[model samples]
Target: MNLENLRREYLKGGLHRDQLADDPIVQFERWMTQIIATNIPDPNAMTVATVDADGQPSQRIVLLKGLDQRGFVFYTNLRSRKAQDLKHNPRISLHFPWHCLERQVKVCGIAEPLSAAESLKYFVSRPRESQLAAWASQQSRPISSRSMLLQQFEAMKNKFGKGEIPLPDFWGGYRVKPQRIEFWQGGVHRLHDRFQYTRQADDSWSIERLEP
Candidate 1:
């Protein structure tokens, strides 16, 4: 397995300090807007990492449902593995792997559950089937097979019966209040550009460049 031959040069453009916004959220939205315009699939998808109480780390891809100065928001079943980990330890990390643009963003933050009102608002906006699926899936829990899961979904459909699917008691969203965020852009010769924004006590961001 001598697989060292799988590397490619990142010839994309470089990021400069002058181009960065004072607010990381603004910078993030700028990048997000660009990526969305490119029609790339699931540009809002991000990798969320959390550690259990026993110190075991886990990672999974989740959609970025909402974003603003408050933080990045995502929804899931409260019983899910990631949700359980967040319960044990609210500290969390998120990564946006926009490799097509040779850029990425990393965030370290504290995870806080979104209010029930907020969760319900977002939940109702979802497609009916997705809303039903949320009710059917136990998320991190085990299932016997696809047929059983489908049966559960079918049961939910029949129970709801063209009526509005209520938000499940165990389903909700979490917002990651970022304490530190880093934006990285690939450069020629591997001299990548990296800038980090750390939140100050005054609630302002302090930006600095780091070695590639």
Candidate 2:
């Protein structure tokens, strides 16, 4: 296969500075609402990037479970690799690949653990199976076989036995308080339109157009 031949012009639309919101959180909400209305698969999905103590970087896709002025929120095992990385270096980045709409969003921020009450609120709202899975699997850890994992899952099911599955001690969520946000729109001839919003010390945002 000739990879170089795979090319297509982006003609979806253009993003302009005048069209952007002064607050990036508002801008992100606007885009998210539009995408949600379009019924795209996993519209809440985002790629989270983190770095470990030694400066090794890693990335993973996580669903955006919550979003507001406080920033983006997602859950995971506290012992997971991404969580470990975040514990070492609170700096994190998020990417929303809305390629189906020829758009994307990038976020740079600090990752902080959510309050226990907040995590429990979302945790109990999850389906029973998901709640059990949280207790069954040791995320980012190697397992000898699929069967062994399934066995643990089954064990969790029996242990719960129709009772409410309490949130695991090692499971919770984090909020990414964004310092910078960028919105990108696909333009014809690869001349994409990009706008960046940076947070100021006064808790306000400054917007600027960036070259694509």
Who wins the lDDT comparison?
1
Which residue pairs collide, candidate 1?
Answer: none
Cα-lDDT of candidate 2? 0.94
Model 2 TM-score relative to the real fold: 0.98
Worst 10 residues of 2 by lDDT: 11-20
Residues 1-212 of candidate 2: C-alpha lDDT, one tens digit per residue: 78998999898788887888888998899999999999989999999999988888899999999998998999999999999999879999999999888999999999999999999999999989999999999999999999999999999999989888998999999999999999999999989999999899988998888999
lDDT score, candidate 2, position 81: 97
Instruction: Give the per-residue lDDT digits (tens) of candidate 1, residues 76-144.
Output: 999999999999899999999998999999999999999999999999999999999999999988888
lDDT of 1 at 65: 98
Q: Which sections of candidate 1 miss by over 4 Å? A: none
Q: Which stretches of candidate 2 lie over 4 Å from their true place?
A: none
Which lDDT values do the candidates have, in the order given?
0.96, 0.94
- Counting clashing residue pairs in each candidate, in order, gives 0, 0
